[model samples]
Target: MRAIVVSEPGGPEVLEWREVPEPRPTRGEVLIEVTAAGVNRADLMQRQGLYPPPPGVSEIPGLECSGVVAEVGEDVEGFAPGDEVCALLAGGGYAERVAVPWEQVLPAPSGVTLAEAAGLPEVVCTVWSNVFMAGRLRRGETLLVHGGASGIGTCAIQMAKAFGSRVVVTAGTPEKIAYCLELGADEAINHREEDFAEKVTADVILDIMGAKYLGRNVSALNTGGRLVVIGLQGGLRGELDLGALMARRGSIISTGLRNRPVADKGVIVRGVLENVWPLVAAGAVLPIVHEVVPMADAARAHRILESGDHIGKVLLAR
Candidate 1:
């Protein structure tokens, strides 16, 4: 098999496609023939030596992929050879084959092509877990998402709207703001020109710019609001107004999916299959893809993600 290897951690140019040993399924795991892999900011972080895979996981940079089942390990059930599936991986998605725990693998939804399904697992799981399960975004409430045109943001907009929540977002450009509105966001604030804290209050805020937005995010929250920080695009350190947060009875949570135990990921995967996949199948929510690059040119895919010009997911296909 062939896989993308980050040799010595540097720019995207360091990614090399080379022959590698094929992986085999272990107990309770399934082996998949890779189709397409989703490119995420985390992948770039890993390439730059800022993030490393969890112990006993693969070194390849991808976090999610859509593929066909080639074999099932002992104790695996409900999935057979040749099943179309997508999975949330801890690592190793940039290869032609991946071995994943059965719990994190899901049957591809009915409406979208298998290639596009590659973009769903990471975003769907992130949104479902942080925005709904952890953040407790309820129907009729307003949810604010940072990076409105991103893969996670795009999915959040559609999913929140489908569940009867009003969605608001912040973007850096006029084009991005318009695109967010097209995806059902009720309000799109230009972060470059306007202060989001003055524009609206929200019941829940899915924030990615960790430190830069910390103080303002608290100020923008409605009473009893929830702030879930899932990314650190803006740096890691910040001071919070504890008095204000206490007055509003607000809560803050910081989380990530890549380091959780498989049992926990299983719960999130099942939640998505039960609650979110239906919306995808019914056309109420859909995956947004910006472009698909070949796996051999994985460097190009990384470059696209770093450009920040893409409206949605950038994929690497076999």
Candidate 2:
């Protein structure tokens, strides 16, 4: 088997595709022959030696993938050899083969291809869990998404629209903003030119720029707003104003997908399969793929993502 390994962790140049021993299924796990994997910002962080894989996990740097199950470990149920599935992973999706807990796997949605399905797990689970489950966004409310052209942002826009909520988004370029509007964002703000805090207020804000946007994000909130921070592309430290937050009765939360326990991930995965899968199958929401590069060209994929030149998900195909 071959996987993308971080050769000393510095830049996209550090990612190398090399031969490695194939992984086998463990208890309640399934061995998958990966067909495709989604490239994420976290993978870039891993390459830069910022976000290491969880202790005892694979060294490869992918968070989600689509594949065919080659074997099922003892005690795993409802999945067998030859099952076509997509899964959420803590690591190792960059490889041609990986072993993932059965709880994180789901059959490919009825309408999406196997390769495209690879892009769904991470974005879908992240959006569904954060926007709906934690942020508590509901119909008739306004939801704000930062990096609206991103894989998670694109999915968040569509999911909010499907739930009958008004969606607002921030993007760096006009073309990217247009793309988010096409996907269902009611309003698009150019983060480069506009102060989102003054343009509009939201009942919920899904932010990626953590520290840099914290103050403005709090200011942009409507009364009773829920602010969920899922990424820290800007920096780690921020000043919080308790006085302003208290006046609005707002709540701020920060979360990460990796490093979570398997059972916790399972709960989120099950919520996605039951509540979000139908929307995907019906085309109310869909995987937004920017490009699909071969597995061997993963370094190039990482460059595209790190440059922030592409919109939506960049998939690495096996």
Candidate 3:
């Protein structure tokens, strides 16, 4: 099998296409013949030596993939060989094969192509866990999403809207703002030009570009609001006003999917399958794919992801 292997920590140029041994499924896991893998911001972080794979996980950078099940492990039920599946991974998605825990897998949504399904797992799990389980976003509440045109942002917008929340988003450009609105955001603010804190009102904030939005995000929240920070695109260090949070009874929670215990991710995957996958199948939520590149062009895929101009997920096809 040919896989994208990083020779060293550096730019996308360090990613090399090489022949590697095919992986086999272990107990409670499944070996998937990778059809497509989603490119995420975490992948870029890994390439830059910022995020390392969790202990015992593959060194490859990918975090999510969609493909057909080649084999199933012992005691794994509800799935079989040849089943179309998409899975969340701790790592190793940038290959032709990936062995993923059965609990982290979900049946591909009806009417979605294999390429598009590759973009589902990470965003779905991330949004569901943060927005609902942790953040407690509820019906009729105002929700704000940072990086509105991103894969997770787009998914969050649709899911929040589906759950009856009024969604607002922030993006870098006019085009991205329009795209977010089309994806169901009630209001879209161009973060590059406008002060999003003044333009939108929110009871819950789902943030990706963390420190950069820290002050404004706190200011934008309504009383007793919750803010969930999932990424640190604009550097991790920032200044905050404790007085504002104390006065408003505001709370800030930060989390990441990678490096978490497999058991915890398995639980998140199960919840997502039960709560979010159905919405995807019903067309209430859909994967947004910005582009599909061949697996051999993994470097190009990484470059595209780093450019930050893409409006949705970038997939690498095997």
Candidate 4:
């Protein structure tokens, strides 16, 4: 087996595809012969030595993958060999094979190819958990999304729209803003020129710009609003306006999926399969893929993502 190894963690150049021992399924897990993997911001962070994998997990820097099930571990049910599936992983997605807990695995969405399904797990789970489950975004309410051109952003826009929520998004350029609107966002704000806080108030704000947008995110919230921060693209430290937050009865939460327990991820995956996957199958929600690069060109994929030029996910395919 071969996987992308971040040798000494610095830049995209640090990633090296090299031979490694193949992984086998353990109890309650399954082995997937990787076909495609989703490249994410977290993978970049890991390459830069910022976000290390949780203890006892793989060092390969990928978080989601789609492949054919090669073997099923003991105690696993409802899945069998040769099933086409996609899975959320703690790590090790940038490889020819990955062993994942059965709970983290899901049947490929009906309308999408197995390769494109690689892009769905992380973004779908993130949006479903943060926007609906944790942030409590309800139908007929307004939801705000940061980085609307991103993999998470694109998925969030469609899912929120499918559930009848008004979606507003922020992006860096005019083209990106237009793309977001095309993907069902009711309004698109160019962050480079406009202050999003002055334009609209939201019932739920899904934020990726942490410190830079913290104060304004609070101001942009409607009464009893929920703000969920899942990325720190801006910075980590930010001062909170407790007075304003208290007055509005707003709540702020920061979460990460990679470090969460397998049991928790299973629950989120189950929710996604039942709720979000249907939207995807029905064409109400779709996986937005920017480009598909070969696994050996993983370094170039990282560069494209870091450049922030792509509109959606850059997938690495076998």
lDDT of each: 0.96, 0.93, 0.91, 0.95
Point out where model 3 deviates above 4 Å: none
**Would you list the clashing residue pairs of candidate 1?**
none
Candidate 2 residues 1-318, lDDT tens each?
A: 889988897978888899999998999999999999999999988888988999999999999999999999999978999999999999999999999999999998988999999999999999988999899999999999999999999999989999999999999998998999888899999989999999999999999999999999999999999999998888899999999999999999888889889999999999999999999999998999999999889989988898888999999998
User: TM-score per candidate, in order?
Assistant: 0.99, 0.99, 0.97, 0.99
lDDT for position 112 in model 2? 91
lDDT of 2 at 87: 97
Ranking by lDDT: 1, 4, 2, 3
lDDT digits (tens) for residues 1-318 of candidate 3: 889998999999999989988888999999999999999988988998988998888988799999999999997878999999999999999999999989889898886898799999999999999999899999999999988999999999999999999998888888898899888899988877889988876899998777888998999989999999998877799999999988889999998888777789989988988888788889999999899999889999999988889988999997
Give the least accurate 10-residue stretch of model 2, judged by summed lDDT: 7-16
Error of 1 at 265 (Å): 0.1
Model 3: worst 10 consecutive residues (lDDT sum) = 254-263
lDDT, candidate 1, 199-246, per-residue tens = 999999999999999999999999999999999988899999999999
Q: Quote the RMSD, in angstroms, for model 4.
A: 0.6
